[model samples]
Target: MSKKSKSFFSHFTIAHKITMMYGGIFSLSLLIISFFVLVNVTVIEQNNIKAEMKKTVENIDDYIKNGGELSQETLEALLENKYIEVNVVDVKNHKVYKNSVGKLPSFVRQIQSQPPHGFLDEERNNRSEELEKKGFKVDIAKEFNMDDKAYFISSRDGKEFVLLEKEINFEESCYLVQAFKMLQKNDYYFRSFGLRLFLIDILGIFLSFLIGRYISRKMLKPVEEIQQTAERISIEDLSQRIDTSGPDDEMKELAETFNSMISRLENSFQKQNQFISDASHELRTPISVIQGYANLINRWGKSDPTVLEESIQSILAETEHMSQLIKKLLFLAKSDQNRIPVQKEQFCLNELVKEVVKEMEITTETKRNIIIKEQKTVEIYADSSMIKQLLWIHCENALKYTKQNDSITFHIYEQCEYGCVDVQDNGAGMNEEDVTRIFDRFYRADKSRNKEIPGTGLGLSIAKWIAESNDGKISVESELEKGTIFHNAFPLKKKKNQKYS
Candidate 1:
């Protein structure tokens, strides 16, 4: 057989095997039963014939035993029963004692005309002869073919023998022969029964296969959805989620895992991109300053000592900027590795904001002029150092983007259960687009123009982490000329137990 056909048969399913077994058993049982019934019907017909023959023998035997010759009354009764003929002969006198004759059928006449011999015994003798050739003397009389019909013989007075002969139609043999012939007449009848069963079995198997395939597809539908979901995902489209609508099965769990992996991957990618952008921007600034100062020194140092000294100062300044940028980069890398230890505690947010503003005034360019607009005390539960870092980023960002002499404002207050802080800048305000992406690491609104500023894009990203790490959120609102407002909210701090020291 071809490979495909071989494979199909080899992989035949449980249902196919079941159907074949059922049909095979049913067909086999039917064949066996039909054979037994045919044999039984033939035997019954043979017994009926034998019984009639025996009844005739009894009538003839009674008449002879009564010390009377074959009487006219007995002979008349035998003749009246149609399809029968009888003759009794006296062997000593060689004369016919009694004869009752009727117009017998040809077949019956043929049976009687045959030489007087035991019909069943003679057939058994023939069968014994056949068996003897095969080296076995089988008890042939008990055989089904031999016992189906019978004949008998008797002697009168042991010497003056009277031979009485009677025969019946071979009804069983004739009926069986006719039946066998009829069964052979139409090949389609017998063959079609089995053929139709086979066809039905095949159809049942095919339908079951279709149902199994459909169920398999339904069971695996979630896997298919996961595949399509995975296919749809790219770095830009990682935010997409699986469309789950069924019971929470393993497939749903798989979909959930897939979505989680995408989310994590997207976050990592964003952080990496942010790191690269910040590093490039931060490194470029100092390099540019160093180059400009070096060029200036080369051109004018020898001509003027004051110019040479000023160049040295400028170089020192650029070197300091580079060092600070490197330190921030290192800090960010450590944080990415989760190496930054958190010291959690209940701390005053108002005090933290005040400290941040004081530091900014001391260190930044648009410094002491910035006003603190906070009116109320705010406190929260968080890591103190991390929250301070968050405050520094917001303040520094506000200071950097604002023009010289523009005032910065800080407002601290309570909103519902949250401690809210707002830092407003009155300098170069941002647009909606800038507000949306300002927190991305290393992202600057004026990419080309901000090259002079030694700012790493990671500042706001770090600030965002600090806020979220403590179950808080940061937001921004801005208009092009009206300036920008950076908002931060922290959960309320729980009361700490006072320890007696």
Candidate 2:
């Protein structure tokens, strides 16, 4: 049969859904964690740079504290390790001194030239002209703060440079000292680091997706097998089962459950086919007999009264047998459908058994040596009517199988939590095979459906339903040519007003 279309999401198989969910959630989580980690790492790197700049500031301070003067040589000495520029101002003469020789890194702070008058008149014309030729002192620094200990200065491109300036008393004149830490290398490090991080994140997402898909497929393989097995199974075949040889996990449990369902389907199908075949065979006999008699009467009964009477009697008996068979079938049908109602009450088994035994003795045509050897007044909770019928099924079977002198005994007593009854018979008993099949529908110990047996072969089946429906247990013990014992047990303790329908 064609399947109906489902929603878009429903069209996805379980494996696909699992893969998508696992991969999507984990990938998103990885991205978020990577973002925070990147930010954290950047902050720590910047902080370390700031700390190194402070160390450079202290080095410059120590240089001034000693006898080192802020000249061209002083600035050159500080720039020996690179990434730092220096400046000095002879404020009393309105002249500044700075390092020279090569172009400064563009990422470092640039010395913006101010009005030339920031320098002395003689310094610009005489000292500035001579120093400009030698590239030692010039009026290019635009600002200064003698009180500023350490500070950061930013360029137009969002890059930072650390700077510090202080005043020194030298030759009875105040000299301004300044320092700048270049950060071009740090900028390069950040750009390269960010690129690597982005690439690694992408790779991680790809690998995670592949792993999720593989694991989902492996885990959901059993579910796929179950679906295939079900599709292959039809009314004609239910023997296919999922492989359950694996670790005891949820997947294993699901496989076991699927196999169990298949087994039950096979059993039910077998029972249904057997029931139809047996019912037809049982009915065909009586039907053929009735037809034969009717033919006998139809051709000759107008003049022969004997044949007419025989036909009518045989027809009525067959009809009655069919009716009895129908009633038993209906009982089983109702019981199987769980339509039979239960009304429970506490009752004494001894009194009920005594009454049943007495009734059987009085009504039965066959006289067995019947007696109740032990009758302990054990109270049990169950449906009394069903129990009565259950008792009668055993008693009637005993009467049917035994001779006039064989003994049939009834016993009732308490055993732990159960109230028990035993209907034991000394009769023409059966073998293990017959005993095993005695409770099956339309099953006779004789197996041949003997006419002399006088039974519809439904008594034991009805007896089993009665015992189970009334919340009791029933079992039979028999030996070939020895005897049979039918044991029934019911719970002595059931909640008041417990009902089963």
User: Who wins the TM-score comparison?
Assistant: 2
Highest lDDT against the true fold, candidate: 2
Each model's TM-score, in the order given? 0.47, 0.71
- Estimate, for each residue in 78-131, the C-alpha lDDT of model 1 and write its tens digit: 442333344443322233433334332111212233334354345433543443
> In model 2, which runs have C-alpha deviations exceeding 4 angstroms?
1-20, 37-42, 51-149, 154-159, 163-180, 184-215, 447-451, 479-482, 495-501
lDDT of 2 by residue, 211-272 (tens): 99999999988888888989999998888888899889998999998899889889988987
The clash count for each model shown is 1, 0
Q: Candidate 2 overall Cα lDDT vs. reference?
A: 0.74
RMSD of each: 15.5, 8.1
How much is 455 displaced in model 2, in angstroms? 1.9
- In terms of lDDT, the poorest run of 10 residues in model 2 is 137-146
